[model samples]
Structures are given as structure tokens and as C-alpha cells.
Target: MTGAAPATIVFGAVYATVVGLCVGSFLNVVAWRLPRGESIVRPRSRCPHCSASIAARDNVPLLSFVILRGRCRTCGESIAWRYPAVEAGSGVLWLASWLVFGPTFDGLLAAVFCSLMLVLAIIDASHLLLPDPLTWGGIGVGLAGSFAVSWTTPRDALFGAAVGAGGLLLLIGLWYLLRRVRGMGLGDVKMLAAVGAFLGVGGTLLTLFLASLIGALAGLLLMVRGRLGWSSRLPFGVFLAMGAVVSLFFGPRLIAAYASLL
Candidate 1:
């Protein structure tokens, strides 16, 4: 890493963080409306409790939430903490991406990928839904980005997508044949395809491994706590998002380490 001036790096980080926060705010809107099959652009943000239109000032991302003490200004109804949390988390992720990849094409791609994953993770966690707009759009972006970015080739992206989706389908089919029950949803397969498009085949495989490892741990914990049973479905998309993010940042090192071990 270049020993750039502290001020310059700080300025870049702040700029990226601000952009991420704005994107996060928009993502929150998308998450709320997409699952309901409502137009995200139409019927501007409103208080769910009182059905009052939100003013521009009251919708200023994290600032507005803090100013209002996490309540709707129009109705005084308590707002979900997820609003500010997502905004803050997005900002941190943007900052991290900028720091990792710097001001470059790869940095831009990482930031965009992180943003999409964050939004999808939140949607899946909250509503158990991963909309096509994000998954399919992500695959398109990944393929297009590979042309400009040096990390992966277009061929790798295509191969990754095919393998990711195909592997999941195979697993689902086998599980259904053996257990007469669905093992996973199409959304997960599509989401993995998107991740593979962005990260290529090796990264996609790593993502699946990491997601499964963490998800199994989480399920075991939940079961032990009596919060979940064997039949309870976990939001698998959230784990995939987590794995994608991890693989995005550390995949090269991880692959290199594994190769060394071998």
C-alpha cells in the first residue's frame, strides 16, 4: 500500500462513506417496497404506523433518525433501529472497500458489490426474500465490471455463474429426491450465481463453504436455544451475503493459503 497522506486518505474515505450512506437509505426503501410488490419510486416514504408522508428533512438517513430519536416525526411512532443501523453499516463498508482497493476501478466494483450484498442480506434477514432486481442486476453488473476490472476475466465470471447456479440446483434436486422436501430456494441459487459472477469459480466455492459453515453453526445455536427446530428454515441468503463479503475481501489470500497448505 502506498503511504499516502493521512488527509487525502481521510477525504476519500469520508466521501465514499457518505455515498454509501445515501445508497443505504435508498436500499431501505427498496427492501420495504420490493417485497410488497409496490413501486419503489411511487408513493414516497411514509410512516407505516400513521400512513403520513415523510418530509425530505425527516428522511435524511442516519441524521434524521438520530434527530428524531428513532421516531416518526409526523406520527411520533417509534421507528425501527434498522434504518440507522443499515446507514451506518453501509458507510463503514464503503470506507473499508475504499481502504482495501483504493481509488480505482476495483475499488468501485468492490463498493458496489458490497452495497448490493448488504441490501440483499438485510432483505433476506427481515422478509426472507431476495428480489430479482438485485440478484439478476448484480450478475449483469459483475459481468460488465469484469471487463474493466483486472481481478477476474469475463470467462471466469461466466463460468462462475454457471457453476454456482448449477451446483445449487443439483443439491436441491438431490435433497428433494431423498427427503421429498425442498432443500433451498431459487433465490439462494440466483444469489450465488451473482456472487460467482463477481468473484469467479474459486471465490464462489469459498463463499458456499463459508456460508454453510457459519449457517450450520448458527442453526445449531438456535436449536440449542429452542428458537429453531430441524424443520425451521433459516435465511440462507443472509449467510451467502456474509460469505460473499468475506470472500470478496480475503479470497486471494485464502486461496493462496490453502494452496500453500496443499
Candidate 2:
């Protein structure tokens, strides 16, 4: 609005970035611990190498990593680069959401989507496993968020969930019928369901298209490098996260562009 002050906007942007970085730190803990059935809330963050409880000063996200020279203060063990990278990436994503979507419920939802996508991508890439709690919990939160945001209504969210999960479920069933083996993990179906809950049917479809294309190209590249075989399994959820995040921010434009080409 013309009445909005530049200073206010700047403050909001800074606040969002700070919050994102903090949340990113928590997300890292979740990615590392949730898969192992550890309580994320309990026991403070510790060094994976030395099991020394990290001090609050050393837990300050990106700054701490740099301050500590990327080594554990207790054991001199090297810290993973992903820690600071996630924090930086998350801050950027939050800033992008604020700039692009503005300070509104839509922006908040966008930020949340980015957060979920980040952790999901990290977990899937590292473990090749997508935990049910996250997928299921994400779906519930996304559906709830729809009532607050203008874009996706309750009916649309439900339809989207069906379309996203149903499409994958069908493929899973067909693969089982034909090959007598599970072709994909149920985690994927649930993940898409969560995506659909936030994005709606069209966005869900767009995400699928983008993830498939990207995954295929990646697979081909790996095959060429002799790192992947025909029977090799790719962590598909990571690509899905990439696609969903792209769709969340740019789906309408991409969809229109594709339609024009057809």
C-alpha cells in the first residue's frame, strides 16, 4: 500500500531473515535426529563427533560456525558445512518470501513451505528416507494453513491432496501389480499430499512435472558417470522438494508458459 513506510518494510524483512535462520538451526536438528527416533526438543544440540553439548554461544547458526572455524570447540572435530549453508539458504528463502509475497498470511505460508521443503530435501538426500511424522504433520499444517491463506480453499486443498497422493498411489499399485515389487515409497505419496495441501491441484501437477523432469536428467547424468544403474534408486523426495518449492513461488508463470507452447 502507498501508506506503508519503507522503514517498516525493512524491519519486517530483517525480522523474517532472523527468524528463518533460527528456524533453520532447529530444522538441522530435526533432520539429524527425527530419522533416528530421537527427541528433537530434549537434549541440547551436541557435537556429533565428540558428544559434547554445544554452548548457546556456539549454537548461533552461521556465525558460530565461522567463529569456531568449523571445528568443535570441545574436540576439534570438523562441523558439517551443511549447517551454515542451511542457515544462509533459509535466511535467503525467507527474505525472498517477504519480498515476493509481502507481509501477509500468504507470505507466512510461503515461509513455512520453504522450511518444510528445506528439511525434507536435507533428510531425503542424506538418508533416502522420508519419515511419516514429517509428511503427515506437514499435510495437517498445510491444510490448516489453507483456511488462513487466500489462494487455496478447504475444498481445493482436499482435492489437491487426493490428486497428489492418489496419483502416486496408483503408480505404486501398478508397479506392484506388474513387477510384484514396491516401485516407490509411501513417504513420497504422503509428501505430495502435503504439497497438494499447500499448493492445490494445479500446483501439485506442476510440481510432479518439474520433479520428474529434474530427477530424470539427474539420473541420466549419474548413469553416464557410472554411479547409477537401471535398478538404482534415487531419493525422489529431494527432487519433489525442489519442484514443490519452485511451484510454490513460480507455478502460475511456468504453467502459463507451458500452456502457450502447447
Candidate 3:
């Protein structure tokens, strides 16, 4: 959905960025806990080194990291840089959503879309596992949201889901038939299906194209650096997340530009 510009750029930008950072912080917890079969809500966020509950003051997104000097208060252990990076990245994404979609339902959808993609990207990159809760929950939310959003209809959303998963499944079959080895797992298939539910057919197709292109470039770079072999597996879901983010932001413009040429 294309949303009009926000009424006030300054307020909207600030609001989006702050909320986004907070969301990112929470997602960091989700990414760590969901895969490890831990409750994100039960135990408060703690320093891994000391198991000390992080104070509310110390959990204020990027500032906390800076104020703490990237160290645990209780133990003085170094914090992972990933935390602040995710917050900053998420802030940018949230600001981008506000700029692109304004403060409409469409904007909210964009933010949610970005959040799902970000957390999934982190999880997949770390564990090479896309948990069922996120993928399936995303599908449910996307399809349910289809009726409320202007950009996609329920039928198109369903069709997109089918195409996203079916296309990948077909490719998997072909890869195995030719190589006698799995190039990717079913998790990637399900992840794309979630993408499709939110984006519809054209968006999903474009996402796949962008992801393939980027993934190929990354793999080639890795190979050139002797850091990867053809047999090595890269987390396809991470690339998928990147592709979906691109698709969410610019796929419509790109599609329109291409169609004009056609």
C-alpha cells in the first residue's frame, strides 16, 4: 500500500525511529530466545556473562550500549555489537517506512513487515534455522491483514503464497534431481511463502529475483576470498529477508519502470 506523506515530518520521523529502535531491542530478545526454546517474556533480559537482570535504564536501545560502554554493568563483560547494529538498522527501516508510507495502516504494515524480516534474517544468519512460529505467524498475520490493506486482495495474497512456496519447491526438486544434494531446506520455502502472503505475486516474484541476485554475488565473493566452497551453504533466509525488504520498499516502482519499457 502506498501511503501519503505524514502530516509532520519531524514528529513522524522521531516517533518512527524511537519505536523502531524499541522494537528492534525486543526483536533481539526474540531472536535469541525463540530458537533456544526459552521464553522471551518470562525472564528479564540479562547479561549473558553474569545473568544479572538488565536495568530499565540500561535497556534503552542504542543509548544503553553507549552509556554502558558496551559492557555488562555487573560483570564488565563486553556486549555483542549486533545489538546496537540491529537497533540502528531498525531505526533506519522505521524511518524509511514513515517516509514511504506515512502514518497510515499501510505504514504500520510496512513496519511490521520490516520487523519480521529483520528478526528472521538475524535468526537465520545465526542458526540457519527459521523457526515455525515466526514463519507461520507471519503467514497468519499477512493473510489476515490482506483484507485491511489496499495493495493486495485476499485472493492475490493466497495466489502469491502458493507461487512463492511452489516456485521454490520446484527449484528444490530440480536441484536435488540434478545434484543429488539439497541446495536449500524447506524452511526457505516456508519463509518465502510468508513473504508472498504479505506482498502478493508480483512482489514475491521480484523478491525472489533480487534475493537470488544478491545471494549469488555474496557466494561469488566468498568463493573468491576462499571463505566458501560451492558445497558450503549460505543461509538463504537471510537473503530472502533482504530481498523482501527491497521488494517492500521499491518493488512497485521497479515493476512500473520495467512495465513501461515493455
Candidate 4:
């Protein structure tokens, strides 16, 4: 499909980025509350250190962090930089989605996919937990987007979900048999299934390969820093989310390049 004019694209990207920043603020709530089994809506974002309610002015995504100097206004406790970082990262991802897919339904779907991946990545990295709401909800959204957008057919999305979950399940079983321990969590399997629903089998496979490559690199880095050992657990979901984002943007070109090389 033809893209929009340069001016229109620029405007759309900016608009999407702004909306993403707001969404990222809410995502912070989701990542924090969901793992704790708390209601994200009712609590209204209090400082974890002092239990002071955040004012509306203090909750303006990246801007608030800057204004507050990354400290709680009430108690001066240091706020995590991850809050503003997620907001900025989400804005960038939204801008990238609009740039790649243009101002179309596909662009909206891409933005939503990226947002979900971001939330999953953050939760997994911090808590080593991937909640069902994000994973299962993402699967539903991905399947709906499959029919709504031109990225993949429904059949391919279905196959992708099945293979993504099934492949991981098999690997986990094998690991258990060989090591007498569960190597992968069900959350990772479900998250992959959700990714497959969006990306199809080829993209899912590419995500797995990319996740493995990056995860190994990260593990090596941790080991070198004396932070990890052979028995240390690494959060695989974060790498999977990263790989899915990369595949979302570049899977087609990457697959084509590999095919040409073959």
C-alpha cells in the first residue's frame, strides 16, 4: 500500500507518540499491580515508599519524572527511572510503528502490539512474572488484528499460536526429562503463543532464534559481571518480547534476506 504524505506521516507519528506516552503511564500501573493481584484502577498510584497519593501534576508520564527530579514529592524517596524510561520507550515505539505501517489500521495494531510487548518485558524483567491478563489478552488481540489487518491470515495466525505454545511446551518437557527440573515457565509459552498469533509461524520462529541469541549474550554479560552463574535464572520473557518487537518491524525483510542467501 502507498504511504501518506511526509507531513501527514510526521503529524501522525507525533500524535501516536503522545498517545503512547499516556498509555505507558497506565502500563506502569498494570506492570506494578497485576503481579501483586491488586486492582490497578482503585489504588490511584501512591508512592511505594511513603504511601502518598500522587497528584495529577505529578503523574504526567515523562514530564512528571523530570519535574520531580525522579523523587517522591511527599517523602523525597527516589523514584525508579524505569517509569519515565517506559514512557519514552513507548513513545519511540509508537512513532516507529506509524513510520513503518503508516496511518492505517495496521499501524494502530502495530502500536498496540508493541505496547503489550513492552508491558510484558518490563514485568518479566522486574518480577520474573508474566501475568495471564497480558499474555492471554494479547493472544485475543493478536487474533483479532490478524483478520483486521493485512499482516497475516487467520489460519497462519492460528498455526503460529499453536506452534509457538506447542514448541515451547515440548522443549520444557524435554528439559524436565533430562534435568529433572522445569526449565521454562508456562507464562513464556503463552506469551510466545500470543506473539505467534500476531506474527505467524515464520515470524514466531525468527523471534525464538533472536530471543535465544540475545538471551545468551545477556547471560554471558551477567556471568562476566559476576552476577550470574550456571544455576542463576534469567528472565526469558524479556528476551522473547524484545525478539517479538524486532520481528514485528523487520521480520519480512529478514526472512527475505535469508531466503535470498539460501
Please give the range of 10 consecutive residues that has the lowest summed lDDT in model 4.
1-10
Please report, as a residue range, the 10-residue window in candidate 2 with the lowest summed lDDT.
175-184
* Count of clashing pairs, candidate 2: 0
Candidate 2, residue 242: the lDDT equals 93
- Give the per-residue lDDT of model 2 (tens digit) for 52-160: 9999999997999999999999999899999999999899889888887888999999999999989999999999898998899889998999898877898898899
TM-scores of all predicted structures: 0.96, 0.95, 0.96, 0.95
Model 2, global lDDT:
0.91
Each candidate: what lDDT? 0.91, 0.91, 0.92, 0.91
Query: For candidate 1, lDDT tens digit of each residue in 1-262?
Result: 3898999998998999999899889888988888889998998899999999999999897999989998988789999988889889888888888999999999989999999899999999988888998999999999999888878999999999998999888878997889887757999999999999998999899999999899999999999999997667899999999999999999999989999998
Candidate 1 lDDT score relative to the true structure: 0.91
TM-score of candidate 2 to 2 decimals: 0.95
Off by over 4 Å in 2: 1-3, 174-181
- lDDT per residue for candidate 4 within 143-257, as digits (tens), equals 9889988889899999999999998899789978898777679999999999999998998999988998999999999999999977677889999999999999999999999
Badly placed stretches (over 4 Å) of model 1 are: 1-3
Candidates 3 and 4, the one with greater TM-score:
3
Which sequence of candidate numbers ranks them by lDDT, best first?
Answer: 3, 4, 2, 1
